[model samples]
Target: MSWKDEIEQLRKRQALAKGMGGPEKLKRQREAGRLNVRERLDLLLDSGSFREVGSITGRAEYDDAGNLIDFTPANCLFGRGKIEGRTIAVVADDFTVRGGAADAAIIEKQIQAEKMAGELRLPLIRLIEGTGGGGSVKSILDMGATYIPFNPGWDQVVANLERVPVVSLLLGPVAGLGAARAVSSHYSVMVKGSSQMFIAGPPVVAGIGEQVTKEELGGADLQLAAGAVDDAYASEADAMAAAKWFLSYLPNSIHDLPERRETTESPGRRDPALGDIVPRDKRYAYDMHQILRSVTDEGSLFEMGRNFGQSVITAFARLDGWPVAVLASNPKVYGGGWTAEAAQKITRFVDLAETFRLPVVHLVDVPGFVIGTRAERAGTLRHGARALSAIYQASVPWCTIVIRKAFGVAGAAMMDHTRFRYRYAWPSGDWGSLPLEGGVEAAFKAALAGADDPDAMKDDLNRQMKSFSSPFKTAERFWAEEIINPAETREKLTEFANLAAPLREPRTKAPRYRP
Candidate 1:
């Protein structure tokens, strides 16, 4: 009767906890096209790199002999893990355990996991499914006491956003606290068709006389459009891959800068087609995404919030192995204007970059902030001003490239400096207070009124302004830093990225991340 009996008892408990919601539940998870808790961790972390923290914690039933009779593991899978050799804290909830009910100890454990990430200053990854410590109707029946549902550790979670990188992946239905955790991260991913996030599920909302399916309430398409989720993947494996790829450019914490990676992609690599990508005519549009990919490392352009704020594209990419946060205007939507939603997206994206110390790259083709009645009602100007303030306040290195039309305040928002700037303009660059096409009439109104043919006078004025609007004129006055061939834009940009690398590594800001 030595310590061997105690060791065997502990092993028995651990084995049962590892079984998760049990064999029957694992089968149901696979049938529903979702990866179980353990499988998700395997897919996300490097092989044999996960060190689980609380594998033996949960409700249990033991006999007087201290032998395990029945055991129920916590609904969470958490601990320290490595993704690509970088250590991070992970919190993945097991939905199979009574649908991730709010068992008291499990809630405390989840809170501790979040605090550990913040205290350790490590990037936190939340693979959330089901309610996060949500109400358990069955638990109430067992305890014979009903209690209100709530989640602690929100403050620690928010602090994690400012201290380190945070990403959340929603692989199943998320309600209550789970929904909050899903959207609170700097980056979030949802599995298409299989995932949904809502304030309350249909069953709870049905009490209010409303009935809607989970997908209809908070599907991937809907959440992405709402700008709460960043990207959507076809399956859990795809989402897992996405999460790993995203963390590649980010560091473990804001106390340091993102690590530079070895690259076969040459710094001088130029896309010959870049010269022809931006049309000479402002009325015509080209794919901004294609241009982004061409300038970035091959196959390294990871886009965020694609469905929401389509006019402005925010992406994380590598330029010759240097990680960069790219903000590009998409003329394909609203002629590249900054809508209210787009402004919000840009401000948040810029904050993420500043938090993680990623240098900013602006591919400017902005037409200005969104106009018309809807734009004003949505307070586009307020959001635009906030975005502008973020750009002005950020101390991160900035590089601007005027690819096409850049007009008004939105165009000016591209960068805040003019002297000794690492900025470039392509041959297709065209800029003014407003587009010359529309401004010519206002600028020479008296002269046009006096002309016999107002239409002809307008055409003459257009030709005259076009000549003055050349990027060459701006360069002649030294207002524009460099006007390079479009083919050489990427090469020049790579040089700028290299220059910015050292400046970012030493970070001493008290508020490293501004929400």
Candidate 2:
């Protein structure tokens, strides 16, 4: 063939692949108020920065003259692109074609995309929807045979988790392997009304004699509350923006480190309100969110697992524009005691921070792990120990500011216990093996039972114990770190962040995750 003829053939093939599924299917995507796969890329990436990887791949129908008659592209689309001046990889599912099912070269392309991201040490943004290259009924009919359920690229998928920063956006109904991919990323988002995720869709559930609608099975509200996904946005555009913002806080890969940026607030900035942030009366509950906002840079707290672990708040925040993981105990829930679910949440959050080499800050108020029949049934101790193990295994710098009560084993798990002299307690802090109120009842039970004025005796002992257990007494022994003014938290934490910045080893080791 002449050069001119070959060029004409190339143009024809490019036109076929670029056409996507066709106008009719694409119109349906628009009618549903969602952007198509190609359109999503345009919105997500810097304009004209996306470089195609497998644009010529698809199922091509050839005529007798060896001329192409039809073409159906792979449901998976991928390539390198720039987001906010940072280079990264993007993989999106083309639901218009085969519902992103097992067809053509989608399975291979999807697997390759994961491998490429890891190899290039780039961040990966997954625009997930449909089946995520899962089994399709039509595929079996076309092949005249059935195959056992399996995920071909799962190994690469799993490897990518530790190698790169991954963000998944659920733009449509995700099922089976699709759901797994959507949830596997470090950060994930879903469109509030349009996105749903499930291990199996309604039709698959019907085969097992169960009846349920798609929304009822795995709606964003249920999934977010259950801690299956990190967040949900009102639109795909918003979700994309969130994904971009998340990447801004993280490095392109585990091999690199997150750079600090300038913020509107100075490092030494302090709010006078934090002086009275905690009430002297231990019985009253204060809003932990207020403390989080006051200490961290303005609008930099990205909270995770807020619903599943109400007792503990795990969030990503910035101190002097340096990213740090913040864990604060909320007294309103179980008296800030750690539950099994809350412990698991801590393990996961710690892993993210450590993997990205971020420092950690603990706003301590824990009384202990949740205690009761319910807690025992939930294996609270087992999960609590795992959460502790995760903290101990982390190599990043850690600091703790004791805001209130910190009692028993759960208190010990608050920070890197090995980082001696690193703990900081507040003036209102009260920590011991057990709170004075509870200790008096247990220790003076015999004395109280025999005393004529049992109630008075109990009250007197509690008062004495509370006075003896003051933070000053512990500081006198040089056991706990200095007890500072509550309002000084931001200034101290910002200084600590500055001190820890140079201590982190290059490409710091990833976190030890609790199962």
Q: Quick one: best TM-score, which candidate? A: 2
> What C-alpha lDDT values do all the predictions have?
0.86, 0.86
Residues 398-425, candidate 2: write the lDDT tens digits. 9899998889999988787666547788
Q: Give the 10-residue window scoring lowest on summed lDDT in candidate 2.
A: 506-515
Task: Give the alpha carbon lDDT tens digit for every residue of 233-337 in model 1.
Answer: 998888888888888889888887888878997889778898888776678899999888888888889898889989999999999899999999999999999
Clashes of 1: 0
The number of the candidate with the highest lDDT is: 1
Question: Residue 138's C-alpha lDDT in candidate 2?
Answer: 77
Per-candidate TM-score against the hidden true structure: 0.94, 0.96
Give stretches of model 2 more than 4 Å off.
Answer: 508-515
Compute the lDDT of residue 278 as modeled in candidate 1. Answer: 78
